[model samples]
Target: MSGNSVPGQGAAPRRSPEALPPRSKLAITASRVTAAISRRAGKGSGSVIGGKLALRLAPDLLAQLSVGLQVVLISGTNGKTTTTRLVAEAMRAAGPVVSNALGANMPAGITSALAGAGDEARYGVIEVDEKYLAGVARDSDPVAIALLNLSRDQLDRAAETRMLAEKWREGLRGRDAIVVANADDPLIVWAASSSKDVLWVAAGQTWQEDSWSCPQCGGVMQRPGDDWFCSQCDFRRPSPTWSLAGDQMVDPDGRIWPLHLQLPGRANRANAVTAAAIASLFGVPVEAALERMKHVTAVAGRYDVVDYMGRKLRLLLAKNPAGWVETFSLINPPPTPVILSVNALDADGKDTSWIWDVDFTQLAGRPLFVLGQRRLDLAVRLEVAGLQFQVFETAAQAVAACPPGQIEVIANYTAFQQLRKTIKEAAQA
Candidate 1:
C-alpha cells in the first residue's frame, strides 16, 4: 500500500456504520414468512417478495439491518451483478459481506439481502438499480458507491441515459459516500461530476453511442486521445486515478498491476479493476483482492456453461445494446452456431426498439439461430441487415438447428433466466 499510494490521496476515510437504526424484528419476521411462502410456491430466489414484505413491515429495513456494517453499493446499467460479486469477494478481508446474490437489484431485493445477512457480517455489498440509487443510497448509507456506466436500457421503464445521469448527480451531491465512477463514460462522468470525494476509474465504456453527446453542454464530444472532451463546454472525462492499461491496472501513483480474472472479456476485467480500486479504498491488499476475484467462475448465470439438454452451451445474458456489444466481443464469431434469444417481457423491457441500436450487421452472412418471444422481430432486423439467420419457435429447436460445435447461447432478461432455470433444474435432476 505504501509503494502504490493506494491508501493516500484517492483513499477515503473508513466509515464503519454507527448511529444507524437497530435491526427490525417485525421486518425480519415478515421477510422470513414471505421467503418461506415464495420458496414453497416454487418461486425462484424469493428475494423480492421477502424484501417487499420486509420493507412493508419496516420501511427503514435497510437502514436498520445496515447498522454497524460498512456498505458498498454498486449501481449501473450493466455488470452490476457481476461487479457486486467481485466486490463482495474482495471485501471479504474487510469482514463478512452480505450481497444480493439473486441479482435482484431494487429496494426490495436489497432489503431481502439485509434480512438474510449473517449477524457477524461487517460489510454489505449491495447491487442497486440505477433508478432507485438515491433512496437506496440514503437507506444503506454506503461508505463507497460504484457508479458504472449508465446506458439506454429498459426504455419502457428506465429514464434516458442523460436524465438518469442528472438524477445521479443531484442525488449524490454532498452525500457522505465516496463515489467510484467510470470516467470513460460521459454519462457516468457527468453523474458524479457534482459529487464530493469521487475517485475515477477509467473502466472501458463499450457503448459510445449512448454517451457521444456531452451531458452538460449537449454538444458532440470529441475523443482525441484516451480521454473525451466536450467541444462547447468544460465537461470532459476526468483524469482517472485508476485506469486499465490492457490487462494491467495503473493505480493512482502510476504503478501498474496485472489484472487476472477467471471471468471472460474486457468487461469483466474492467469490472475487476473497479472492485479492486474500491477494495484498496477499504485497505484491502490489491494482490489479495485480485486473487479472491480469480476464483469466481460465474455470476448469477451470466457466463455459466451448463448442459443444455445434454449439449454444452455457454449461457450469456445481453439485456441491452451495450450489454449485447460487450457480450458479442467476448465470444468468437461465425460458424459457431449461437442461440440468439430475445424477449419483450416486463423485466426484459416492454419496448423492443432498442434492438435497432445494435450493430447486428456485423453478423451479416454468418449463421445465427434466433428464438424467443421477439425472435420474429429479430428475424426482420437480421433480414434487413442481410444476415443469414434461421428462426425457431423454441430454444430446443434453435439449438438443434445450430451446426454441430460448441454452442453459445445469448438471451435477454426473461429468456436468459428461463434458460438458466431449465438447465439448472436439469443438472440437479
Candidate 2:
C-alpha cells in the first residue's frame, strides 16, 4: 500500500452537529423536503431539482456537506455509474459510504446525495460528469480520484476527447489526491500523468478508435503486445501496478485474484478491477473487496432482467458508439431477438449522427426491433448497414411482438429510463 493510504479501522473524526451555518442547514432541510415531495408526487427522485434549489439558497452547501469526510470522485465517458456502485460497495468493507447510485452525475444531483447522508457516513463515492470534474474536485477535496477511459460522447454538447483530456490534465496538475487511472488508454494516461501520486491500472480498453493518436505530440501511436507508445515523442503507456487478465486481477506482486462478479461482459470485469484498486487505497484487502463486489448484479437499471408482456427482457444502456460496441458483446446470440431504442432529447444528445459510428452490421442475422423518438434515424442507419429491422411505437409493442423468450433491449439515456418506467408500470398494473 502507498504511504498516503488511509486506515480503514477506527471511528472517523466526527464533525460538530452544528458545523453548518443556519442558512446551509436550512438549504439541506429544504432539499430533503422537496426530494420527498417529488418522490411522493411520482415526478422522479428529484435529486436534480432539490439540489438545484439547495445550491440556489446556499451556494457553498456542497463544500459544507463535504467537511470531515473522505471523498472519492469518479469521472469518465463510460462506466462511471457502474464503477461508482462497485467502489461504494467495496468501501463498505472499510466504513459506511454515501453514493449517487441513481446515475445522477452533475453538481445538483451530487449535492442532493450528500445532503441526505447521515453522520455515520464516513466516505463519499461520487460519480461526476467529465466536464464538471475539476470544480467538483476543488469543492470536495477528494482523497482519491478515479479516471476511467474517455471516448466520444454527446458531441453536440461535449468537447472533443483531446480537449477534455487537456482539461483533466490542467485540473489534476498539482492536486494531492491519489489518481487511479487506466494505462491502456493514452488519453487517460496523459490526463493523470501530471498528478504527484498515481496508481495506474491496465484495465482493458475495447474501443480504440478515439485514441489512435498521442494527445501530447500529435503523432501516430504504436501498440506492441499490450503496450502503447508515441512514434513522434517521448510519450508512452505507464507501467501499471495492477492489471486485469481475463476474469482475474493481477496485483503488484503478481498474485492472481479471480473476480467472480455477477455483472456481465469484459467491461464489467474491468470495472471490478478498477473498483478493487480504489478500495485498496483505503486499506481494504483486494480479496475482500472483490468478494463484496460480487453482490452487485445490477447498477441502476443496467443489466436488469424484468418480465414484461410475457417476455424476459434484459435492459442494457448504451449512450454512445463505444458504449454500443460494448453492449453488443453482452447480448444473446444471433437467432435471439434484440430491440434498439434511441432518443434525441437533451439528455440523449440532440444530434443523432453518432449512430453512424457504431457498426450495426453485427446484428445482421438477428431479429431487430427499433423504437423511441429517433427510431427512424436508427432504422436508416441499420438499413445502410444492410440489416432489416422493424419499427415499433412503444417498448410494450416491441416486446409483445417478439417471440416469447429471452430478449435484449439496448437504449440510450432517456430511452432506457422510459423503458424501465414502462415495465414497472405494467408490472404494477
Candidate 3:
C-alpha cells in the first residue's frame, strides 16, 4: 500500500495564498470574520453561517480552498465522524491535515473547515453528508473518497436506501478519486462499483435489513456464510483488498496488523480498517495508521465518559435502527443502568416513528431510563417491547437514580448535543 503506484503518495504540494483568486481570498477573509463574530455572540461554532457567506461571495470557495491539497471525502449513514477523525489523524503522519473534526458534514460546514485551514495544511479530510456527496465531490476534487456503509436514516427527510445508492452511483460515475468502500454492504458496493478505481474493505455490517434485496436486479440476495451475491444479477460482494480478521486488519499483502483501538465495538474496528486503507494511499503504513487510530478514545461527544453527580456517564449516539443496533453492542452488560434519549427536532428528523423500527428488546434486562424531549415516545416503544423502564426529566435525575457506577446515555443528534452541553456546563461550574 505504501508503493509508488499508490494514488497520493508522498507529501501533497502546498497552495500558496498568491495562487488563490482575489475573490476567493476575500471570501475566506469574510468567512473568518463572520465565524469570529458568531463565536463571540455564542451562536455555536459558526461554520455553517461563515461558510454560507463564503459560498455566497465566492461560489467556488471550496474548490479554491482544496486546490493543491490531497482531499479525502468520507460519507455514509453512520460512522462518518469517527472514521473521518481516524483518517485525518492517520494522515497527519504525512503532514498537516485540516478536517471537520466537529462532525459538521454539510457543504457549508465542509467549506468552512477548508477555508479555516492554514497554508501549511497538505491534506484535507472532510466528512460529507451522504446526500451532499455529489456536490462535494464535484467541488473538492478529492484524491480519495471513503464510502463506509449505507442504511435507513431519517426516513421522513432522507431518501430510501436504494435511492441513496443510486445517487451515490451517479455521483461517483466519472470521478477520478480512489473510492475506498465497504464490500460488506450491498448498497455501498452497488454505489461504489460505478467508480473506475475502488479499494474494497471487508468491513462487517451489523444491520442487514436495508440490504436484503439486491440493489441491481431487485431480487433476493443470497448470503451464504460471509459472502453475499444477487440471486438474479451479477452484483456480488467484491473480494476485499483489506479485511478485518478479529482484532487484526489484513492488508493487501496479507500482513496482519492488530488494532488496539480505544474506541469500542466491531463497528469502530471496521472504521479503523477503512481509515488505514485511506491513510495507506498517502504513503502512511497500515501499522502506523493503526497506532495513531488507537489513541482516539472519543469522537465529537460519542464515547466520551463524563463525571456527573458522583457517577461516570458514558455518552453514545445512535440516530437510527442500524446505529442503535451497533450502539447496543457497545453498552456494558446488564445490571449497569442505561439512559435512552431521543428528540424529534429538525436536525434529528421530525418523525419519531423510526424508534419503533429499533429492537429495544435487547435492552430489556438492563436497568433502563428514558429522557429527552421525545422521552414519552421512547417510553411507548419500550413498553411495546415489553421492557421495564423509568422515565426521567433530565440526565442528572437519570444518573442519580442509577446505581453508583458508570451509566450509558444513548441519544440521537440534538439530544446528544444537548446532553453534552449540559454536562459540560455543569462540569465547568
Candidate 4:
C-alpha cells in the first residue's frame, strides 16, 4: 500500500477494542445523561450537543475511540452525508459499521458516534466537514479517505475552495491511506493526488464555475466533456479507475454494474458510484455494494415524503450552488408544485448571495411557492430570472398554497432541519 500503514496491517494487528486506553467514565456518563435530557425535552436529536459536552470533558474522545478500527472518512462540500450512509451500509459486509448519518460532520459529531458505537464495531464511516477534514483524518488515521468534490459552501466557516484544497493537499501529502477521489472534480483531484496512494473515480461533476482556474498556476483549465486539464501548468485530471455511464458504474476490470438508488438524478448515481468505489478498496464487491445502496430510501430526509397539512411534501436539501444545480434537475418535467425554502441562519450560511449563481431560470415556467426567512431574497432572484413564484409566510401556508396534491420541497440546511423537526413533532403529537 505504498508505505501507507492502513488498518488491516501492523505486527500485532491491533484491531481489538482493548488496544486503546480507557475513556473517562464520567465524561461518557455525562454525555448520555445530556442526550437523554435533550430527547425528553425534544430539543432536536441532541447527538451534537451531547457529543460536544462529552468531548469538552475528555478532549481526545474521538482519537481514543477510533484506535482499533479501520476508519473510512468522507469529506466534501456536498454529498458527504448521503455518501457516508451508503458506504457505511456497504461496510456492514465486513462487520459492524458505525456512522454519523445525521449530517453532523464535525469532530463533536464523530465523538458522539464513537460514544454510541458498540465495542464489537470493527469499522467506522465518518462524514467530515471540509475545514475539519485534516484534523479528523490525522486523529483517526483513516484506512480510506473519499475526497468528494469541493466548492464554496458556508463561506463564513469554510476556507476558500483553493485554500481548502491546499489544506487537503497538506493533510494527505504523506499519508498512506488509499484515497478514493472524484477525478472529475479538478479541486478534489488537486487536493488528493499527492497522497501516497490514490484511486480515482470519475463520478461526474455538474458545477464547473468553481474550478475554472488551475490550482498549480494562475491559468485557465480546459473543459473537454467531463475531462479537465490546465493550459499553463501540468495539472490535470487523473484517469479514473472507476467511471460512470448514465446511471451505471463501469469498473476498471471491464465490468459494468447498474445502479438503482431510490434517490433520483445523476448526482446521486455518482454518489453511489463513489461509495461503491471506496467499498471496493476495502474488499467489498461492487455488486454487493450496489445491491445494498439500492435499498437506501433516504438520508437525513433528503428524499423522504411527509404528510403535512393535507399535502404530501417530499423533501430535498441543497445548501449551495453546486447542490442546487443537481437538485434542480430533479424538478424538471415539472411535478404538482414546488416549495423553495431558504434561511440565513448560521447553519445555512448567513450570506445568501450564492443563490444568484444558481440557475433559477430553469424554473421559468414552473410554479414555485417560496417560504422561510429568506423568501424575499429568493423572490427577488426569481423575479429577476422571470420565474413566477408565490411567497408565503410559513411552511404551513406554503404547503396549503400548493395545488391539493403531492408537493416537492427543496430547502437549504436550516430550512430542511426545521421542516424535519416540525414533521417529527407532528408525528409524535
Candidate 5:
C-alpha cells in the first residue's frame, strides 16, 4: 500500500461482532450485508466491516468512487474529529454531506463512510487519521483539506508528528487540493507550505506572545503585540485571515447566548478556531459559522456531558498525549474533581511511555480519581508527578467513589468506551 492508501482497502467490513460469514463468500456477503445494514441503519449506504474486515476489502472499489467525490479531509494530532464535524456541518448548511462521524479515518473506514454518501452527493467530509491521510489522499483527491495542529500522538503504528507531516508533504504533492493550515503550529505550517491555496489561520494575538519564539532561529519572533511576527529572521508567522481572538471573545451577535463548549480544555479553543476557519473557507460566512459554533454540542465520548441524578458528568476521550494535555488544560484546581482512566491496547498504543511526555504537573493541585485496566501504572505516574489521586481497579468502583455533581472523567479510547457503557447501564438500572 502507498503511505496514503488503506491496505486491503475494501473487503474488511463483512465479518462483524453480530455474525460471521464464510471467508470465500466474504465479498458477496459483505455486499449484501452492507446494503441491508445501511438501509436498516438509515445511514445512507452499506455498512462495511468495522476494522479488520475493512482491511480485507478490494481497493478497486475505492478507485471507482474517487473520480466523483468532493472530499474534505481533516487531519491533525488533535481536534480533527471535532473540527471535521464542525466543518462538515457548515458545508451541509450549503448542501448535503457524507462523512465518517464516528471517528473512523482509515481506508476501510473512509470507504464505509463514503458508502452512504450516495452516488449523487456533491460533498464528502472525512476526519482522516494522520497516518492514513497520505493513503487516502492518493486514493481520493479531496477538494479541500484542513491540517490542524500536530502534537505527540500514537507512537506505535504512526511515526512521530514531524515524520507524519513529511509523509503528508510527499503524499499530497501535486494533488490539486486546497489546503487550510494552523499557522501557529510550526510543524503544520511547514507541511502546508508544499500545498497550494493555504489559508493560514492564527489562534490569536495575545495567545502567541509567549509561545511564538522561532524554533528555527532561537530568536524572539516579531510581534505586532496583537498577532505574531518575526522581524529578525526570514521565518515569520502568517496573519491569519480568521481569528478566535482569545478566551475573552464575545458572541458576534448577542451576550445571552452562552458559548456552549462541549469539549473540555482551554486548548480546545484552538480546535474551535481551526473548525471556524475551515468553515469560513468552505463558504460559510464567518458570523454565521461562529453563531453555529455557539450551539455546538459534543460528539459522544469526546467530552460529552451527562447528568447523574443530580451530579454532572463530563466524559472526555483522551487517546494520546495531545488529548491528555488538552484535557488537563481544562482542569481547574482546588475544587473540581477529575477521574482519569488509561488503557493499554495496541490500537491505543501499547507503550505507556507517552504518559511521561504528558503535562502531569498540571494536576498538582487538582483532586483526581484514577481508574482503567492500567490504573496502577497511571497512579504511580501521578504520584511520582506529586499529584494526589484515588485509584480504582474498575470504572464502576471509580464512579461509585466520585462525589455527586460536576465530575469530569478523563479517559483513553477503551477506558472511555467501558466507562460510558458502565455509566449507561447504571443509569438504566
Candidate 6:
C-alpha cells in the first residue's frame, strides 16, 4: 500500500466513490436507454429519440465526463456529416479515430455517439447540428472545429443564415483549436475570421439563391453575373488557401477529369472540396487524398447510388434549399424516369415551406413521380411552381409505379430512409 501523499513528489492514493461527488443514476439510465433506442432505430435516421427528448437528456449525461479528451466538432447548414466523415477517414490514416458513421448531428445524438465510441479512442470527430453548435462548444472544449458554409435550411427549426452565423461566431469565440471554413461563403468567411487559426477552402461557384443580401449592410450584394461578390461591403469571397483547381472542377463523367464521384450533382464539388481541405489539414497529402476521394462510394443517403435489378438508381437527400437547387441543376439532360419523395411531419419538422424555395421550375415539362405522406403538399408546390409530376400517396405505390427505365430518387431525411427500405425490401422479395 502507498503511504500518505507527499507535499510535491512522492505518491498519491486513489479515492473511493464516497470521496467523489455522486452522479444521478436516473440521468445515466436515461442516457443508456436513449442510446439503445438510437442504435436500434438505425443511424440512417435519427428520429428514434425525439429531437426535443434528446436535447433534454444530453446535458446531465455530459456532466459525468472526468476524462480530458480532444474532440473535433463540425457544423453547418449542409455538408456537416459528410465533411465530418471525410476528416475522420483522413485522420484515421494518421492515428486511431472514432466517429459516428451515421448522420447524427444533434446534441444528444452527439452525446449518444461519443458515449458509444468507447473510452479507448485516441481522437473523436463529431458532426454537430447547426442549432446545437453553441451547446456543444459550451459542453465540450473541442480540439478543432470546422465551420462549413451557411445556407438557408429549415426556417422553422433553425433561424436564418445571419442568425445561425451569429450563433456560430459566439460558439467559436474562445476556442484555441484550429477552425477551417469555406472562404467562398461570405457568412462563413466573416464568422471564421473571429478565430486565430483559420484555414479557408473554396469550391468556386455553381448557383445562388438567398445569398443575395449583404449581412453587413442593408444593400443588395453585387455579383459579377457569373461569380458572387459583395459590393455593398468589404465582405467578399476570400482567396482560399486551397481551391479545387484544374480538371478537378469539371463534371465527374467529363473526360477532362478522371475523378468520378458516385454522388451525382455539382454541389458534390463543395462536399469534395470540404473533404479534401479537411484531409490536407490532417496531414494527408493532397494527391493521395484526392485519389481516395475519387473512389468514395457514397455517404449513405446523400446522393448515394444503388444498383437494383440491373438498373442504376441514385438516392439524393435534398432537405434544404441549397441542396434542392444543386440537385435540380444536376438534373440536366434529365433522366428518363425520376422519383421524388417528400414528407412533412414531426419527424421531419413539419415544415413544407422549403418546397417553395426549391427551383422546381427547372423540372418544367419533364415528368417526375412525387410521393410520400405529404404528397399533396409537394404536388401543390410543384403545381404552383408550374412543374409537371405524378403524385402518389405512399412511397411503395410510387416506387412500384416507377417507369422501367433508369430512375433517380430524390428525397429528404425520413423520405430517404423510407425509399431505401422500400427498395431493399422489393429487391429481397
Total colliding residue pairs, candidate 3: 0
Error of 4 at 380 (Å): 0.9
Task: Give per-residue CA lDDT, model 2, range 244-322, as digits (tens).
Answer: 9998999888999998999999999999989999999998899889989999999998999998887889999999999
Which residue ranges in model 6 land beyond 4 Å of their true spot?
Answer: 1-34, 37-68, 205-207, 225-229, 246-260, 307-312, 427-429
> What TM-score goes with each of the models?
0.93, 0.97, 0.97, 0.95, 0.79, 0.82
The full ranking of all candidates by TM-score, starting with the best, is 2, 3, 4, 1, 6, 5
Candidate 3 — which pairs collide? none
- Model 6 TM: 0.82
lDDT of 3 at 319: 95
Best by lDDT: 2
Per-candidate Cα RMSD to the true structure, in Å, reads: 3.5, 1.6, 1.9, 2.0, 7.7, 7.5
Model 6 C-alpha RMSD vs. true structure (Å) is 7.5
Judged by whole-model lDDT over C-alpha atoms, candidate 4 comes out at 0.85
Q: Write the per-residue lDDT of candidate 6 for residues 1-429, one digit (tens) a residue.
A: 111111222212222223323443344445567656766766533332633353464444442331344567788777777777666766666556667657767765665555544445555677888888777767766656778778877666768788778778877776676776776677777677777677766664443565677666755777773345677667766656655553364222222333456555555666676665665555565556566666656786566667765667777777877777777766535546677888775557677888887778777655688888788888899888877788887656665666676577778878888878877877888
TM-score of 4: 0.95
lDDT against the true structure, per candidate, is 0.83, 0.91, 0.90, 0.85, 0.65, 0.65
The C-alpha local distance difference test score for the whole of candidate 3 amounts to 0.90
Put down candidate 3 lDDT per residue, 251-301, tens digits, no spaces. 999998888999999999999999999998888977788888989989998
Model 5 over residues 63-99: C-alpha lDDT tens digits?
Answer: 3444555678899776777877777766666556778
Candidate 5 root-mean-square deviation in Å: 7.7
Point out where model 1 deviates above 4 Å.
Answer: 1-23
TM-score, predicted candidate 2 vs. hidden true structure: 0.97
